[model samples]
Target: MNDLFAPRIAADPSGWNPHLAAVLADLATTDAVIAAQLSKWAHGWGAPFSLGSVPLSAVYATHVAPWNPPEVTLMTAKTILWIATVDDWAERDDAAPRGLDHLQEVAEGKAPDPHSALAGALADIRDTVLGAASSRRRGSLWVKATTALLAGMKFEHVASAQIRDGGPPPALPLYLHHAGQTIGVPLTMATLWASAPQPACDSSLARLQPPLESASQAIRMANDLQSYERERRTGDLNAIALGASPAYLRTQIADQVRHCLEQLRPLLTHPCPDAQALHYCLHFVLRLHQAGDAGHLHEREQQQQEH
Candidate 1:
């Protein structure tokens, strides 16, 4: 994985934050492999919701491993989307990253500041990927978050020189809301939800269908179709785990998740806006499935392909 996605450094590449680089390389491979596999699966199933989330998750695996700041911002944005789109929204929040204290520090741009380190990495990433256009420019939500973060920091003179001496950039005031908290550089589930726009009831309920229906049919499907239990276990586990609240709450939540899934399931048959959107959807479902169940959803898909 390291060899596969490792970026070539001009000199002493591996030595330059070797640990971080190794992690990044692993993430690149993981994401790429998952994305490639999922892409083939989507085509075969002719199902198109936001499968793009798989690649985005792969993208996130890179950010979380070594705590890259720019990647953190990207991860936060993705989390925001995930919480907004998934049923059992609260459960999604719990599974995602938390807190923005680091982001605030990044905005501040002080030396040895975790925030600064993160901010600098982001700056470097932007420069590498988007060129100088990353300098004080806001393009996408991620870019905007970066820009806002950079603009909000207060640097001491000593820290300022360190930045000149090749350190991380200052922090920003970017706040991603989650779990009723407004945090900077959100890496948590709460913060991720905090950053997302409020979902209307209709939208929220539509997301619940796949898991609900899949769960409901699991036993019957298993008896009628021997492979059904194994194949559907992932979705069932996710639904049950996420729906575990007070009895009344579970009922309400299950209803909503089922409803949402029903509404959106049809969209899976239609063309997605693009690969990114598809990837987003795929990533969310996979994550929920992975976190709540085992990797059965992905595994079953793979088995189907091999056969």
Candidate 2:
């Protein structure tokens, strides 16, 4: 699991930005320097499993604000990098090793390690994207949204511990409720924070909480579908880990999609930046999953070798 990471839904080439790729290529030296200072890397970038997947930061920014200028593209990518970096290290145990301890400290407003490059990157991302007025308005909400995945990860940790001790995995109904957040709900909303600085973006997030949950659930289920066999073999938590009905997961995913569209359609008529960003997220992810999630390119590589 060290080699793998989350937000693996952006594998579709339709979301690829060749010029952006070139820009990232051009900035390779700069990224290398930053990576050196941080001493950490992200999937789809400098990490071990980056072969076929670009960092979520790059690919997700392209999908979120493709119309933005290059500068915004880079800024959003950095924020996404920060998200994935913290996510990568949040694990406490090797079996489903993701927790909220470090992020919890941040959520409580404790400064990260003073010399850590991740802290610097996070500050740069926030200062670059969040303006004074918008920051003031969105501070609490940002904290709330940023740590949204904590509970889900903590639950998984406990569940993993129980399973490790020969206890049963969590029940299907209970697991389904928190499953969506297992991969970090904030990733879905990071694009909103990346969106143009508008005070409306703050309230826009509040209004869209329902749809955001739906989107998270939908994405997690898509992951379940794609990683079911891998998870079954590895004894990881999965919707159908106990051999539950894939058809049931499909039906729930469809329901979530409907809920997202139904709730988002009304917001689209208005000019809410966060709503627009979420709309893009839901649309892109649904299309990607419907077509099939291919972001775990390393998995494909392993499969080919096995064959």
lDDT per prediction?
A: 0.33, 0.59
Model 2 residue 167 lDDT?
Answer: 95
- Candidate 1 similarity to native, TM-score: 0.28
Clashing pairs in 2: 91-97
**TM-score: model 2 vs. ground truth:** 0.72
Tens-digit lDDT track for model 1 on 1-307? 1111124346665467877777768666655664565445333333222454455444443332323343333444433323222312212233212222343343234332333323343333333333312222122333444433333221222233344477753332111111112112222222222222223222332343343233323211112122225424422121122222234333443453355355555555643221123223333332343332222346556777999
Per-prediction TM-score to the true structure, in the order listed: 0.28, 0.72
What would the per-residue lDDT of candidate 2 be over residues 1-307, giving only the tens digit for each residue? 1111134444668789898788757555444443333333343234322222334345665676544555555655555556545544443445333225554555546666554444544444445444432565455555555555556666766786678799988888678676766554454365345435666656566668789888888778877887787666655678887556788777877788788878898888977767777777766555555544335555667788999
Position 214, candidate 2: lDDT: 86
Off by over 4 Å in 2: 1-56, 69-72, 82-99, 114-135, 201-203, 290-294
Cα RMSD for predicted model 1: 20.1
The candidate scoring highest on lDDT is 2
